[model samples]
Target: MAFSETVKHEIMVKSARHCCVCHRSKGLNIEVHHITPKGQGGDDSADNAIALCFDHHADAGHYFAGHPKGSKLSPAELKKHKESWFSLVSQHKIENPKIASVEISIMNKDYPGFFSPVFIRETTIYTDRNSMRKMFEFMGKNPDSYVEEFKARFPQNDIYGKHKMSKIKTYDDLMEYFNGDMEKEDREKPNTDPQPHKFELSPFMREYKVINKSNCVLYLKLTNGDKDVLEDYKLYLNFENVIEADSVTKRSKFFDDYKYSYNVFFPENNRGEFIPARPVLVQNDSVTLDAICFRPDPKAKFVNLNWELFARGVFGSGTIRINIKSSFEQHIRERHVEPSEIKPKFIRILPKWNFE
Candidate 1:
């Protein structure tokens, strides 16, 4: 029988990755020894195993083979060492500990593209003192002032849906909950209460003019109108009725071949670099995205371009809509009209046309 990885990890965490007898970190040589020798009817349980360094495994004074007669540590003494070490580790963890980040994907079953979204959030295992107290209280333990101090420093949000709080008995259990493997209800469900955080899109101008007949630029300002600061909010942009033109023909004869080509840029820098449509952080009362550049095929005629912006945060989510009218003012030489006519007939036309 061998100790499972899960049990081994739990023991290691509780022991602070050190030998129970000598209090030495196992750099390259760590062994899990059975307190009651396996030969003497010991099962491979966590309570029956103790982590030891190479020196402590063979130390004559603490652990020895064949029942040495002189001052050797009994199984009872090893159990005491394991208990004391785990307590020390737990106390140190309550004082100062590293936190784990968990990312959960939330999707609206009705709206796949618009509603399905994933958010990366840090867990409250290390920072939420009140949560720890709640766990202890659930276990019938009296919580001390340390829990209050933790609650003051790191506040917990109600955005997380109802969780099985009583199941969390230790810090490891709290981490396991965030890792998404617990036998609990849906984790992505929003709270029953409405969140106060709000987001809005503010267009810089109502209309934009196309430059060089083929290129145009527009700006939309994203503002976090919420009272509370929104952390790690993401912005997404969608464009419609835009297509890419072929370099060889300079235009596509078929309408299906034409696609939208555009770029987004930060107005402050304007380095001519295109910002990929990725998630961006929007602080409370701060503007996130400043500008967007729209470039269409040179051969395109008058077309109405549609733009949609979506935003999601810990508190709430919303969408904004924008429309841009693109019309070409330049005229190209006519091939059907005779050169000798008093004036060649001029008409608004798109270089690319589909013959039906």
Candidate 2:
């Protein structure tokens, strides 16, 4: 076998190793991958390869298709992936092979300078999971103003689900305990356990409307005792709608799971002007849209649309809309309505511009 001596050595080592993602034992059928696609200026050197179990290899291929952090694959990890690939090929007893024929497929095309590496400047926060839970339990019951103060003091630390802490019974209840001066010798400091909260509830209610022939709108309203306040809110329209089967994209594409509402719009589109789209929460009430508008494509017959939700904590609900109209129809009837129960995150009533 006339394999590159360097490649041969790498294969020998990784074939005896374990899979990276799952850390499971690497049995046969493992595959190799180039973390950065060769088509996107990646060299075919061992520094860019990685050995993955068959499933991980497929996942790596999919992630590499448009992976933003293409240049950051570590040399060691790359070597492992390469070794796995070579080991498989060698086991098949394939004779000496030509390298140039290896037309590595490259997906995800972005223009030059479109994406750069992500620089994660690290700071000391709640590295301990126990402390993280205590922090969220502390944040849950505190007033919004107090939470903001805590955030400013500990900007790097998250006090909520971002840290995976769900044991907190109440943000205020936690705050009461934390603020109480129990001496270091006090027996009732706080319970440091990972037991998840039995019934985790979000104080905020994200509301939205899904019109049959119109786009959806979102409302993020926070409940504080008897008063309702709107926190800093914005609407986000995802390429993949996670709400219903009618979505153009699949659920796996959606990154957020706990999200309630998908998109939120306000003031209706009939006015023919761009509303700022941000809504102010009315005290003691949930943010609701007055009306929703649709952009009718004059040349199209119909339009399909769906929504996703984004929130600080839990999301609301989502929905889809199919607007049908004829080209000859002018001044189409206004359509779109709010969804029930599920409050989505970012909500927007999209415009199709024309009917098919």
Candidate 3:
């Protein structure tokens, strides 16, 4: 991950848009360089940032000890220059915030110069037997894609090799296979609930696809609102009153079972609107499927997901709130043997940041 917009903006102001190396105002023709390279265990923090004119930045960036170069900028030198320039800027704070500003380069990006201390990206989903049936029905048209997506969501049961999946095409046959597999797992790890999992599917799928033991299953989004491509980005999640992120088997943990998620979701490729979430590629200024299934504190009216987006050129923290206390309780009440009764849906997919 790289310096966040917050830190970069601060560095730009502290240096008064001047490259600390040359000590001359270069406006937006400057790049913030890390005093100590990230490879050397440096972090994307304000203290590690130094503004350098594009020309000096190129020079300071390239250094080979094997071929001793002229005036190679060292970490110590960068710190000294940054401190000296910051002191000078403080002595003479520019009256105009925009004059000789480094952020002019990003002006067209409509960069939100300041971000909220906490960003709340919230959503809710409601599921019951009918929703499950609808989910499967939606997936019936293309069982092959379902199998691949199902594998991504539940790798443990994806034991059916691709070569064999083509043989099992119908939705009913797929469910039967899953139910049998569920029994297989039950035979290994006996469950106190219904012996065969009458939901018409396997225990593995039930555990993840249906939020039977969790408050709700949701799809979260990771957005690169900036035009810059966020390279080597990692999205980390901290689940409060959420389940642990350990896998019982060698297979990767399922959505509801995972606390540490690095997977991406692509709805377009799969019948995403009707199926569960899973995937992993990203681009600049676009949105993709990227989130969750959880066994949360059901009693808590709202479960808060503390998330950190770490990527080169960007980083920040935010919370995705899933208000579930009432909906979950209602679901528990409606979870009876009746197809006519509808389950209360809490599909709180955030409108502000969803892929249309």
Candidate 4:
């Protein structure tokens, strides 16, 4: 959680692996040193970073207050060196083709957190009179802690099925009917409301909440190479080799629900509006799309997200390969990540009519 991958990439490209202090190319033997120590309240930001060679880093990092041998590099001095080198690189003192080559990379490891979707399920029960009465009476008394144990297994919220909203009350309603001639008039059974003679029914409702899961959340990085500014760009994407079992990332109803040919989402979205990750870009600017959580489908063995970006006078396209297994591994901390196999808890019953 130090300087973001985007910030580090930008600083590295700006410095070209050269030590800002000694001005020597260290190749990969360079480090982005913090101008202000973190414990001293330094923030993980580009302006607070300065690239340095190993030797200079050690020199700048080592200093004993009581046994001071020589003056260490000052924060102001580091900032000046970094600014001078960055300006020189950008102003053509040493040309870097990377400056003009747009690049995109998925920094999954760089991101520390992941997004998770939720599940909502509801089931209805049906049966004949005597069976239903027994069931309700059982429900009213909750023998053997069946209801509590059942909920403990599935872990869910409920509706009127187990509360005051129910049409039948085990004693007040059912026994009251039993005290009347209604049973004799009907005869077949007592408490005959929607006869619970059978103890089975059909599935009623189930839902998955995945809209936010399709957001662009991660240390996903994109850099603009051209010196000209990029403006008013919309990103278009499509998934391939997907199945119904896959997570909503692939099954996105975006095309059908929103009339977009490809899956489209606003960058850095907040209630469908843009934040920092705007639809605009400037020269040598690297953007970390961290505002939302747009990820690969969780059940597909392998998937591809083909993307196309278009601006007023610019167009770019590429494909992002998704490894389903790796996707779940990446979010091992999630409570209910796909494909969830918590041995789902449930009580089965068959119904006659469909529930809406």
Candidate 5:
């Protein structure tokens, strides 16, 4: 009788919520069952009671394997059961709503880049469509700010994998799936070839060469193959706003290979393998749980070329390589690249191990 109005409303909401186990709406027919019997010491509070259908309430006492027939539970047992029911309801509600997460990575050569993966823990309440629209509109005003806000809210390990998302097997498939939800005007534009993701080194190709006149800096050059998909090689560099840079004239003759890739010549650390197409065991021991990885050699070359230019353009300056290799052909050559026009695969880039 001393319960506050807010507490009473919350208890009403709990009753109105669908039943935790049977998926049936509580509505007006739900009965508040005292988890702990009055004869027992169970408190007359919302936590000690749960809304359940008549049939479910009866079945609960008999369904479990260890539950006794006609064996009534004590007040303490009922209270414990009610608490368990609340936890179940919370988990179900959280997973059924929209959720978002963020991932961050460091740009690397052999790998796509070093990034941290973050997940969303619970469902965010938007109250109404207007509230959601306002947030989306706010996000549209400044993408960078929106991205920052997103990263901040969904910080590293902020959420855990409580539910699974629809997995995207390939990039193209993922885009086409999203295209279904776009406006008519947005979809009308000719779908240009896949563009390098903003974080990729397509636009800002890192070039590496020994400058004799003033040997100061070092970098590597990235090239596109002679293929339709190669046209999508234009990428955004993660280095931020780099207004301009200098190019090194010196060239090496070691780049004569059938294929070309963005290689991180000196990968400081292994942030795991990039786009590994299933790990082939190089070595296995029955006694020990350690093994070596033998990933696909997709970067293996078929033809050799002059080493003057890695693929095209001068070193140091940003450049896009265009070798024009058909995506289909690339797929036939290797299944690893089959799923997508641009399969993010890993490569070994040690200065000493020249592809030539």
Candidate 6:
């Protein structure tokens, strides 16, 4: 009999969506296998199921035929592997529940007497098991091929910097190289120029409004007002008291006490991708943006929070400071209160033409 949904979910969760035998993530392909053949009286229980990647599942002396009988993995052997994998996954999740994502913003830094527009492509990488496994497999198989693919995706230019191809032999080497690059970038200074070109808020930006605010939820709308095309515009929020929580803070003292986490949603078009703490591309004239502050302290009656918004794009960059006073009591009392629309009190825009 086929495995039930509950059994499948249990197996996947326990194994952390990875192959039990090889400990490989489920990026390439993962399959659920029966420890004991149903014909031998095995029921569809999670204990009887094991996860395996395509490579290990079909390998000789494992699950398929054409291997010596003694070399084949028995049901007991599969169970042992599954138990070990589950234990490791449980420990990992306890130590690190969520992975932090990285984003490198690509922008043109304006330098005096230089009219050339520098092409900057910021790459974001998530260091999850699946992502790590994919990088390991690809780089280990052929580092040159991986480098070529990256170059194709983000073409290097003379204004920014050259793309140095990495020569990595093992998974450890690849990870070391990646971490080194991230450290170097972190040490570098901010991309924005010291003397930014200033401009008044465009018509679209002037018309922007705050639709509503509830218990930790803020809704917004943005419309493109410039005639020139705007690509890869981002909304950056820097919170005052609530530091953006991440897995790195799992051991920190403030991890539990931190009352809020930030996330964005594009309600107008579901197709748009929302990268945490990164900009979402807006192509249309208008789009609805939702900022969700989750995991509020239930005991607290009111939460006073402050954040700043930094908007960046090819056209220019701008910054705005905002303060919000939210009360759970008020929200509870007036659940159906109309949205409180507000304008951009003040906006400072740095245009691209000034640099040229």
Q: For candidate 1, lDDT tens digit of each residue in 263-334?
A: 332222112222335444334343424323333433334323222222221322222322334443343332
Give all candidate RMSDs, comma-separated. Answer: 34.1, 26.4, 19.9, 18.9, 29.7, 28.0
Which lDDT value does model 1 have at 75? 74
User: On a 0 to 100 scale, what is the lDDT of residue 112 in model 5?
Assistant: 26
Q: Say which candidate scores most in lDDT.
A: 4
Per-residue lDDT of model 5, residues 154-257, tens digit only = 45422322121122233332232233321333333421111111122224575333211101122322232222112111112212111111221111234434
Q: Is candidate 4 or candidate 5 better by lDDT?
A: 4
Instruction: In model 3, state the lDDT of residue 191.
Output: 24
- What is the TM-score (0 to 1) of candidate 4? 0.31
Q: Give the alpha carbon lDDT tens digit for every residue of 1-356 in model 6.
A: 69875676567556766888998765326678888767667788877888888766664124433445666677778888888888988887522112111222212233232111222222333333235456647667554455445545645321234433334444444344454542355354532221122222456654222211122333344555544333445443332322121211112122343222323432221111233343443444555443333212233233332221223312222222223332322111111111242222322221112222
* Per-prediction TM-score to the true structure, in the order listed: 0.26, 0.21, 0.30, 0.31, 0.20, 0.27
Q: Count the clashes in each prediction.
A: 6, 59, 5, 22, 24, 2
CA deviation > 4 Å runs, candidate 4 = 63-67, 97-356
Candidate ranking (TM-score, best to worst): 4, 3, 6, 1, 2, 5
lDDT of model 1, residue 188 = 35
Superior candidate under lDDT, 1 versus 4: 4
Sort by lDDT, top down from the best: 4, 3, 1, 6, 2, 5
Model 5, runs deviating above 4 Å: 1-8, 20-23, 58-81, 91-356
Question: Using TM-score as the measure, which candidate wins?
Answer: 4
Better of 3 and 4 by TM-score: 4
lDDT of 3 by residue, 55-168 (tens): 878877864344365577878888999998899888876421332101101111332431111111232332233344566568674444565566567656545455444445
Candidate 3 steric clashes: 5
Count residue pairs with overlapping backbones in model 4: 22
